[model samples]
Target: MKQVIIIGAGPAGLTAAHELLSRAKDMFAVTILEESAEIGGISRTVRWHGNRMDIGGHRFFSKEDRVNRWWAQRMPPQGAPAYDDKALGRECSLTAGGPDPEKEDRVMLTRRRVSRIYYNRRFFDYPITMKPQTFRNLGLAATAKAGCSYLASCAHKLPETNLENFYINRFGRTLYGMFFEGYTEKLWGRHPRDISADWGSQRVKGLSVSAVLKDMLKKAAGKKQEADETSLIEQFQYPKFGPGQLWEEAAKEIENMGGVIRKNCSVKKVHTEQGRVTSVTVQTESGTEELRGDYFLSSMPLKDLVCGMNDVPSSVAEIAAGLPYRDFVTVGLLVKKLNLKNETKIRTLSGLVPDCWIYIQDTGVRLGRLQIFNNWSPYMVAKPADTVWIGLEYFCTEGDSFWNMTDRQCTDFATQELLRMGILTSASDVLDTHRERVKKAYPAYFDTYAQIDQLTAYLDQFENLFCIGRNGQHRYNNMDHSMMTAFLAADNLLAGKNDKAAIWNVNTEKTYQEEKNESGEGGAI
Candidate 1:
């Protein structure tokens, strides 16, 4: 039997391990190395004081039936309405004879995708819908300016050379400045002009003001819009506890199939013979061990993976060392309630704002986005009926001033921002708090990223070494896209299809890359 070594116990690696074992368990020996003690990577759920926090909001809505089916088989959809739906007397689509979420923990619940933008202490439709209330909120002058600016943009399109122009061509300079400018800078820590237009093409594919207006016209004419459009997607699936539950279940299944999962084991080095990978050196608490593998699948950061290789060209090594990444910090706040009101007609528990998350577009505060944990899953909060659990998200570089602040100092800084935004009245409103930081949470699109094609070409020479995942390819892929890469690699390997192009080509089609998502919808990957 050939030995298969998979690095990084993330969704991509776990999916690869499961697919391989399920297909030909006796033909391959599978071993998974995870750097963290947790099951999921950034997709993991953090627990604090009996409450669970999803690092980033993950909505299990995908255009791919294979991805949806994979999720359903592991955590069956709920046959009965969930707690919030039952309490609110709300209706939801359910699967027949599926597990009951109220009685079982291993069930998936149907959830509405309710996300909005908070700018200037006002709430607006995330995609900037055309409505009287929206215009009223923007004020008559700004509305007219925005309309004229959009017309000017439609007349003379700017060359899509950078991320700023990419957004300007779609949303117009007026609305782009009002919406994308400051918040984007806050997220990437760099102006959009410095970032590549590929970031726009990869994230908000085909989502433009025109698309939103067209969808509005269809809805006004009594036609139900398709879920494929970013603005019109209304429903998605989520595990009963959190996304981590599904990954944890996947990890267990991998172990039950005679696969080995080593946690707290970080792969520090990859040994290559000629152009093929021979073994990897992993570091653990006790000591270091070297394991040989016939095939190597790495889901680690491309920068780390390439830098740790035995030998590499100077130019290739320079590009790998110069790869940029954006770190993330999520501060979980258990508050009694927020000052924001539920003005919308959508009914929610405790008459709370129905938004699952609000993109913080106001540049006054450093917060990039905020998540309401109660709306995610009733089971996530310890006391959902009374307390509102929220997560304040900030993007920064590792070891930066913001990232280097102590947890207490960070929590206080976040609390003050809430007060400044009128989301809270005082620091005492915060019942409890927890802080988490993740390195290389987002693979950035600047610096040496322009020469990535050259790097990939060099790495592809290693026939037995396959890169699979967001960080593996440094393409900022969504969760489904990441899993698809692994699935294709595993299937091709089983069929003795050795060419690596198909594996590398997993979400690279120009049309698909520019039209499917708007940067993963500001949700979990």
Candidate 2:
């Protein structure tokens, strides 16, 4: 049997293990080495006192049927039960209260996406809809200025070089300055002009000022678009407890399928002979051990992977070290439901704007975004009726002051910022607080990002080594996109061929065609 070594048990690594073990159990010996004790990397949910918090919100929706089917096989939808829960000593009931007690293990909840931009102490539709309330809030003067700038942008037609130009080309200067400037700067710690246009293209590719206006016009006329745009998807599925449940179940299935998984095993070095990887050295509680493998897959950060190599080239090492990342902090504040209702002047706790999250576009505070965990799912909070949990996200560099702040200081700062933004009336409203800091949360796309192409090309020379996933590829891919890359890599391994080009071609838009070979294995085209 051919031995396979997988690094990092995130969505990509787990997906690769599942695919390989399911397809060729007798032919391949799969072993997964995960550095962290948990299954999910950034996608894992943190549980505290019967409350679950998604580090960042993960919406399970993908145009790829394969990805959807993979998730469905593990966590089925509510109505269509995948297994007989009664066999597991619980009844399955499809009711308004939620799935039956037994079905809770595999059931997924469908939630409508509701996000708004909180700017200038007012909430506006996230897609920038042309509504009376939006116009009234902006006032005539600012509205006219935005309109004139948009018209001038159309007339001048500036070339889109950087993020600033990309937004101006689409939404014009006035709107970009008001909506995109501060938020982008705060998120990346750089001016929009200094950031690469690739970030804008990957993030806000479909939506534009004209598109929103046209959609609003079509809505008024009671018309619908023929194509289903993924960007404008209104609803998505999520696990009952949190996204971590999906991967945890997947890890169990892999182990049951005769695949070995070693948690808390940190990879120290990847030993390569000539142009192919031969084995990997990992540090565990018992000390270091070397595992030999015919094929190796890495989902660790590209920089670390390059530096961890036995004898990497100086040029490659320099380029890898130059790649930057943006760190993140989420300060979860548990507040009294009654206090929040009174401050917002809403009739009931449920009356508060049903937004899963809100973008903090206001320049008064350092907060980049706010997530309403209760709105995400009632199960996210311990007591739905008595309390609400809000996540205040702040983006900063690893050693920056914001990231260096102690947990108490971060909680205190977030609480003060919430009051300043009028989310709460007083400090006494806070019941409890939890802070989570994530390093290298986002792969930075700056002017120096062009060096990535050289680095990728150099790394591709290794025949048996595959680098796939967000941080592995040094690309800011969403969860599904990362899975797609892994899927392609697994297909290559099963087919006994290397298809690095096709694996790298999986773009941010998730628009890649697949074809089956003579052996009936899926391969990306």
Best by lDDT: 1
Residue pairs whose backbone atoms clash in candidate 2: none
What's the lDDT for all of these models? 0.84, 0.77
After the best TM-score superposition of candidate 1, give how far the Cα of residue 395 lies from its true spot, in angstroms. 0.4
Determine which window of 10 residues in candidate 2 has minimal summed lDDT: 516-525
Mind giving the per-residue lDDT tens digits that candidate 2 earns over 152-205? Answer: 888897777888898898888999999889888888888989888877776666
Give the Å shift of residue 87 in candidate 2.
27
Please give each candidate's TM-score. 0.95, 0.90
lDDT of 1 at 300: 96
Residue 247's lDDT in candidate 2: 86
Q: What's the lDDT of the predicted structure labeled candidate 1? A: 0.84
Q: How many clashes show up per model?
A: 7, 0
Per residue, candidate 1 scores C-alpha lDDT tens digits across 1-525 of 989999989889999999999889999999999998987887788899989998877877676677778888899986544445665632121212233344477888777777788988999887789989899999999999999999999999999999999999999999999999888888887899999998888777767889888878988899885645644676667788888999999999999998999999999998998889999999999999999999999999999998889778899999999999899999999998999999988778778898888889888889888999888886788777678899999999999999999999999999999999999997888999999999998888999999999999988898888899889999888788888889987987798766778778776654452232222323321
